[model samples]
Target chain A: MCELDREIRRWRRQEMRRSSLSPRELDELEDHLRARVELELELDARLTPARAFAIARDGLGETSVLSREFARAGAVRWRRALGYGWALFALSFLLPALRFEFTHEPVQVLSLTGYEVFWAAVTEGGFRHALCNLAMLLTLPALWRGRVRGGRWLAGGIGLMGLYLLATGLSLPRGGGGFSASLQVGYLVWAASFVCAAVGLWLRAREWVPTTAERPEA
Target chain B: MKKPVYKELVAASSRPMVLSILAGGESYGYEILKQVKVLSGGELEWSDGMLYPVLHRLERDGLIAGRWELTDEGRRRKYYRLTARGKRQLARDRVSWRAVHGALEMSWGGGHV
Candidate 1:
């Protein structure tokens, strides 16, 4: 009986693993399986052949290929992705706005100085730096949407690049005394991109394919 | 004893029998098979391997729960038990079964008489 029980546990674990059940879900399933085994033992003690056959008939009704808990997990993953995307978008908008608000006067002064001087200052900031930041901002939505053919790799790469850009931006000299119009425009663009990314991610992650028809009950 | 009817009997008896067993207490794979054999007087036997699928389904439906535990002898065991919902469902099932049985008897017997 113990050997059989071990085998059953092994089998159930394999099934749960295949279903990608998380730690909590696997724990719950293990508990349920254990309870089932105990009940079977008790019934084995009491039942006669015909009655057992009848009981087995009832027990086996409507078998499913996947556990309900695991089935719901896919939806949960999509929701998490959507949430993360929205959070990043919110942060993207908030951080830049905060920076602008704190140094509004300097930003207005910088804005009045015309594009040539502004461009020169930013150029001193380096093309690679600006390009990197721009790329990071642009890639935010792509990462958030995360459904392109190479989405996972792309998102990972973009995330790394974004981190690098952020680190570089922080390390760069804060030469311009305050927020410039160019900086404001850059901030707005980044915020807009983040919002778009959030929306895109939400759309992509949403289980919009009408799962009702696919539901077992349906 | 014919193949098709034998198959039908096997199919129909699987779930209710398992549910009934769990209604008593928790059970595992081999023991469930053994109990079924005993209950049916060996007339309605099931392949030992096929029981897991049914068990999995029942667990999925939230009618039963399963867990693993170790015995004093250092042996691990998986057990299953009925939830409150399952018990209520069993009662409803009993009522429905009785109704169906009664209706069948009334219709079939009235004609014979």
Candidate 2:
């Protein structure tokens, strides 16, 4: 019974890897798997490896190989997308902070310092930085189009944001001084834009798109 | 007369042949292919790559089950066999096929006369 269960698992893995099984094929496979489990419960001696293999080889038709290939391709696509998303998120948050630090501008209040400074930066510098980040986040939607389009938009957005962040940090007032009224307004716009872009991108990610190859016609 | 079409052979033998082969004993991938070829007198040919997916579907359907075992030869092989449900299914399939065959023969005006 244990051996039979192991074989069933092996077959299931193989099926997952093959990926080309039609809905009917998948249904049939599930049925067969269940039958095996039932037979195990019954402790049937007829459920030998030799016999099971014969049934599988003969009963399963020609499309099995295609299904396996499709499944493998899908797994690869999912892993790639997940990796991309994580990297993008990390860079989105970390790059701005890094740029502000390296530039060493006096007006840049949001240094790696006390909570007061951090909050000050968010309240004062947050708007401009957020705007730049919002623009960066917008590129995420274009990513849904295709790899090339998404990559282009993401790269362009990130590059522009980086430049803007560097400039803003360098131009900030020093000695705990607040930003000018015009700078504050600009910062608010940037912050609002960033929030909107982030929300939009987050919503877009929820939409289902085929990460794997196109499904075969029935 | 033209040789039996590959499609016709496949369509005709799909279930009965599969069940019959399993009736002998549990067998794995390559062994099943070898047996089928011998049983069909070398006429029925299935590609090696195509068999695994079908096997998976059959396993999925509860008609059959599979397991991996290490042979005395020290190689692990995946084997499959019919469940009780599969046996019952085979019996039903045989009846239906017999009816279809009977109709075809009757329409032809009797057995290979």
Candidate 3:
């Protein structure tokens, strides 16, 4: 292909990083750009493809601005995606709890489902454990809004909590070896919630990374 | 030579103009833009980059729809046309535009025509 086509392809590749714009949207945009160049050429035969491409590109708009718009649009969409994932996971946690909701004072998940481990967390775990889950829940909105700084906060929060759990779980069992296995399992189960929060934060963090065009603003 | 229209004026009117053009039939960016220049005799000078955002904003607002089609020559093109909602919006816009046009014309003492 010509330089103009090659440049258009290159721009599309860069724009793909935005993730908000679908492949079809990018294809449509490229077609629109190509059409603009063709319009320039039709008006003046002597115009070089590069010159025509430049004019067309200028008229079509900068890739960065367009990408920002797309990114903004994408962020709105990602909220829903993050929301669905959170909802499903939350449901997995809440579903078993539903039947068990009012019936049990301190709930026990009898099923061997991997997710019962999550339910056991909220009901059987201590106040501090529930507080960690609460922190994880609250940080989600900030991350859903696509704030990278919040991701930083989330990483620090979850990492410290995870470390704390390991320290305490190992040390608290010094009363005897009797409490070791069950306590370790409980710690793992509760920490899984923290892990879920971290994973959610990580997904949004990808969206938070500044594009080459946006980094200068920082 | 004609005076260039104010940027804000172009920004203000471009949406109605674009929506009205789409009401005529399905057309792509390049064609709609060229038509605007030809129809206005170059008075409505808009930045090249601004139109897409306007179109996108309109699309996002659900006033229009876009699709891609391959031409007889085997080239793919993106085309936009009005929606029913767009048509309803256009009718309302037409009334508003005419009111503004009448007011301006009356101010200029051309109301009798």
lDDT of 1 by residue, B1-113 (tens): 52333857677667777888888888876678778889877777676446665776677677788666554543445577888877877787778777887998999989965
Worst 10 residues of 3 chain A by lDDT: A209-218
* Residue lDDT tens for model 2, B56-111: 55666678886555455333445689989889988988898899988888978865
Query: Positional deviation of A199 in candidate 1, in angstroms?
Result: 20
DockQ, all candidates in order: 0.04, 0.03, 0.12
Instruction: Give model 3's share of reference contacts.
Output: 0.29
Per TM-score, the best of the predicted structures is: 3
For residue A104, give model 1's deviation from the true position in Å.
Answer: 20
DockQ of 1: 0.04
How much lDDT does each candidate structure score?
A: 0.51, 0.50, 0.63
Candidate 3 global CA lDDT score: 0.63
Compose the digit string of candidate 2's lDDT tens values, residues A79-107: 24433543444443332322132234464
What is the interface RMSD, in angstroms, for predicted model 1?
Answer: 14.2
TM-score of each: 0.39, 0.38, 0.58
The segments of candidate 2 whose C-alpha lies over 4 angstroms from its true place after superposition are: A1-218, B1-4, B8-12, B110-113
Listing candidates in order, what is each one's chain A TM-score? 0.34, 0.27, 0.40
Model 1 Cα lDDT, one tens digit per residue, A152-202: 444445455445434444343344554422344333334344334434444
